[model samples]
Target chain A: MTKRAGRERAGRFLAEGAQAVREALRYGQVYEVFVTEIAAARNSELVDEARAADVPVSTVTDRAADGLSETVTPQGIVAVCELLDVSLDEALAEPKLVAVLVGVSDPGNAGTVTRVADAAGASAVIFAGDTVDPHNGKCVRASTGSVFHLPLARSRNITAVFDACRKAGLRLVAADGHAKTDLTRVDLSQPTAWVFGSEAHGLDPEVLDAVDDVVNVPIFGKAESLNLATAAAVCLYAGHLR
Target chain B: MTKRAGRERAGRFLAEGAQAVREALRYGQVYEVFVTEIAAARNSELVDEARAADVPVSTVTDRAADGLSETVTPQGIVAVCELLDVSLDEALAEPKLVAVLVGVSDPGNAGTVTRVADAAGASAVIFAGDTVDPHNGKCVRASTGSVFHLPLARSRNITAVFDACRKAGLRLVAADGHAKTDLTRVDLSQPTAWVFGSEAHGLDPEVLDAVDDVVNVPIFGKAESLNLATAAAVCLYAGHLR
Candidate 1:
């Protein structure tokens, strides 16, 4: 359940908790829904909904459910859903706002950024240049079904992503902490693709140079900077609010 | 290294990664610094700074460093630092802007909120009523060492927290999705303490009732709600920008 190879081989992944499972049933290709006796009793409505969707439901013991669960406190309900990866071109074919994650390896940060991008009305999210797999269980759970809600794409070549964004008529904006221009000065109303880097490294110098512009989220306090996910939220929401 | 009891007994916690270790040395009571040989070579500046501060530096094998790391991909650098905690009264005594996390059990979320609070120029952060311990290794790492930048407090009683906020003359604002007022409409320039709840359950009814007002971070799109950490960032930065 934890390994990328395992999820890839099965072509399906587990979605835990009622909200995620329900979302999987609604927007994703669900193979089966697994619920412990207690979870079935607690979430009869969701189980019934899954059944109505023609999705198979399996009843497992609490111990078995615990074994299948990854979280410390199991939600007792898990859904097996087909992978939700879309090609970069397909994801960006028709987009207004886009979020490009460059080598964002932390599942929590990746998921949080996806959720924020979705919340900010971004049209698509692209995991570019060695970014963590979007299908990782932790990423899926952190996204809270956002991975299903929006178009998601992945690419190894960051240059190709930039080319696609340019072809899609999206301006490439890098979110850099050291940028001279602040985020507030930038006009995000136009179709724009915001690029963010990994936790350990900011955007590569080459990637930064290729972007149309680099902007910084203003830090009014003594703290060095915001976390990766928080920075993405602030930037994306700024675009939405603008 | 994982247990809260052990950290409490030792009155120290591990701060992982170069960023966190650097921040700890700059702003925290770092007792010792541990780095893998590769990290030592790659991060000579950090090692030199640590040594310059008269702090003990230890070179350990990658495996030993991994044993001390809480993250999946060990950053190869860790710092043993004194617990960064303050009394609730001390934290609230002179706070202008504050963040009060209620029942936020996820260490990642808790630490992210602390980091956001610091970046937003908040005077202090309080983990109130069944919240995760600030000294927890995961929480410390997630803070990116902002856990040391400002005062942090913990309380088992939410009511006591509210009482302290009231005594401090800070407006209590609870981040509620169902609230009538949107965050943009709220005047955040005034002294305030924003209260957030756990990922599973938002602010308890009792806690909500005791707060001065309830506000929601408006969702412009289909995402049901923002992740806890992201919401904190948006809300806190909104206050900062205002």
Candidate 2:
């Protein structure tokens, strides 16, 4: 099946590996689960969760499982569940505290930012451009199921999103590791849309151009940068709690 | 060969693949680098750095590379250089501010904590028990090379580390995430030692048993937990910068 086709087949995205599957069982809004014969037989935890949840569980060939997987290493288990579908319009109407992730490719980093957003009381998390899918198992797991709880979705038109946010009385705040604006000094109580970029390339230039304020977390060490997720967490925490 | 022996022979710790290697180059303090015949011929950025720095470089077989590697996928590059040894005796001599990592397994998490400690200007970082090796390429990279710049090392006896810290005037602050004390409000100005635990389990009873205060980064949303590295960063940034 095509990648999008596979995504469409299961309302929930595919998540693999024992730990990720375990997390799905515990926290993911899992509708149903599928496992290959080898994996199901070998990983009793998967079998137990499938049995305990009384969710429909089935077996496929390892090759079949491989074909369905988007990851390099598929843990032979997949779950189909409902989409998170947090609405931008709803979030804006309420508080206009939104988080936009731009071009972040790493699932772990993206998931982490979602977790940070959720922890910080972000009303929504908007993904723009080539950012990885939140439903990717790694992203889902990295989120620790925060994706299941937050207002999150993928949006292609970033400038338009910013425009709408501004129209809703939200200011765009971009987080740069090197920006001179101190996070502690930023006024975060107002309606705001905090934007973070890809771990490597950071925010796209176009997106950067649209931001109302470019801010930074001060760094006083020899290390050139913070991990993307860690940086996002600091900003989000500062934004909400400050 | 045994893991320790393999590292000893190469004068290098195991780094898994291209990503890990990229991280090491970006993050590790020790710059001396080497490449397997295959990796050098691939003419990637790492090989370029090795050549540019005029650091001693060499090539070995993929098999040899794997043997020397510390991860599942070695990707044919490794480095041999000094792992920094940090001394707390001096930092303790003044106002003793230390951060301790307990039972953290992910090298990335461990490294990022080290980097944050440096950024927060904590006098030292003390790893208690089987935390991931600070010098491991992944951890080093994750730290963004923070391990090299700070006073840091592992302690077999966590109690002693805490005792030493407490005696030197550091207040033991443990982050429980659910704790009632707001981290920002807590008096972190004292010589402080912040204790963090593994992502999966959080602070250990023994470690938490030793803390002077337990604090939380108040969450306004539904995230179940923060990424290990990100949580540490928030606490350090909020409480440690002097």
Candidate 3:
């Protein structure tokens, strides 16, 4: 079953939809792929590419596809891509602008932030201890296939990441709803690292203490908080503008 | 059932989540509320406030709550609130700045635009002919309840909205990915309406043809397109700064 192959294997991760699988192929990360038999005649281009590239391909029924696809609207093509291995020691070596995601369990939000990091030219994005897996299919899709584009690393040892950032001489800016300073005023051009927490709760107090600065986006309405992806885009764009 | 009440009934739309239901009462919108008996006892503040406000309240089982909640994460509260009815004729009477959502189906995206509209201090937000219902629970929560604070109106006929803008000496600028002019250079200070379309498919060709001018955000990356909410926020923030 796809569920068994997708989750049980530590070396393998599933990617759903055409854009995601196409991106995996583009990035040379595909280990194996599956396309539901129903799409054999319809998705000729992908089938042709998979055949020409000599990537292992399989076909299954829609019922199997249902168990395989992460999204409600499946695009028929699903891929098993190699899990990327990244080390904090190496990421700190050339750090200019590093980003941290804390307790952000939503894979889509995590993926969009990674894409933003790539777009804004950040040095790296680290998924802190409690954040979602950066390689999840929804995140891969939201990044518009950006999962293969940048220096994004996941870390279970978040304290070590903070220590590494300090050693790298980067400013630690935590995005908070209660912070005093305006994010726009902070010098984003400086060697900086941004820390963001989950949507339900902002940064945990312990993690919040590890960062050097806390900043906020000035809100002028009744909305409780900005969507995490939107806020990430804003901060990343601010850096780009800088 | 909330499903049966879909978009047509205005006086009472389904307000899901404890947070949203609380906001509705705080904003004085709870005409009636229906929660599972457990839900009422779990969050008594909302139930108590409904009673103090002389609004009707009822209790049902968890299964009944499941039938009523649009979102999966229903925080034990579902409210029926009075809808705001702002007219284009009323809004464009003396326009300064405006935004229009053209056939945007995502309630969350629609809500962000509403919040940004208020944050950017736009005179109003116009939902063109076939947009998602503004009162959707996710939409309301995403707006952070800004939908209550913003001057938003759904137009039955959109051409009349444009005519009203013209009568008020307002300019209509359509945001296009392939537009010749850079949005950063455009004079957003004028009495204007910035228009955005659906995420997957853009504006209907007929709607695109009627706008006075087109503007594009400069792109420096390999991304196929920006998410609709991020694009809207970027443009609206620019207008907010202007």
Each prediction's TM-score against the native?
0.79, 0.81, 0.87
What is the C-alpha lDDT profile of model 2 across B116-147, one tens digit per residue? 77776667788777787666667766665566
Q: How accurate is candidate 2 locally (lDDT)?
A: 0.72
The lowest-lDDT stretch of 10 consecutive residues in candidate 2 chain A is A1-10
Per-chain TM-score, chain A, candidate 2 = 0.79
**Each model's backbone clash number:** 0, 5, 1
Candidate 1, residue B169: Cα displacement in angstroms equals: 4.6
Per-residue accuracy of model 2 over A92-121 as CA lDDT, tens digit each: 676556788888889888888888888888
Per-residue lDDT of candidate 3, residues B179-204 (tens digit) = 78866678765788888988888777
DockQ of each: 0.47, 0.48, 0.37
Name the docking class for model 3.
acceptable
> How close is each model in CA RMSD to the real structure?
4.7, 4.6, 3.4
In model 3, what is the error at residue B159, expressed in angstroms?
Answer: 2.9
Tens-place lDDT per residue, model 1, A1-242, is 55678888988888889988988888889999999999999999999999999999999998989888888999899998888888888999888899999999899889988988888888899999989999887888888889999999988999999999999999999999999998888877679999999878898899999999999988776678887889998888775444
What's model 1's lDDT at B24?
A: 87
Model 2 CA deviation exceeding 4 Å by range: A8-77, B5-67, B71-78, B91-97, B178-180, B240-242
Report, to 2 decimal places, the DockQ of model 2. Answer: 0.48
Lowest lDDT 10-residue stretch of candidate 2 chain B: B1-10
Candidate 3 ranges beyond 4 A from true positions: A1-10, A60-74, A89-97, A166-169, B1-11, B59-76, B92-97, B119-123, B166-171, B240-242
Q: Who is ahead in lDDT, 1 or 3?
A: 1
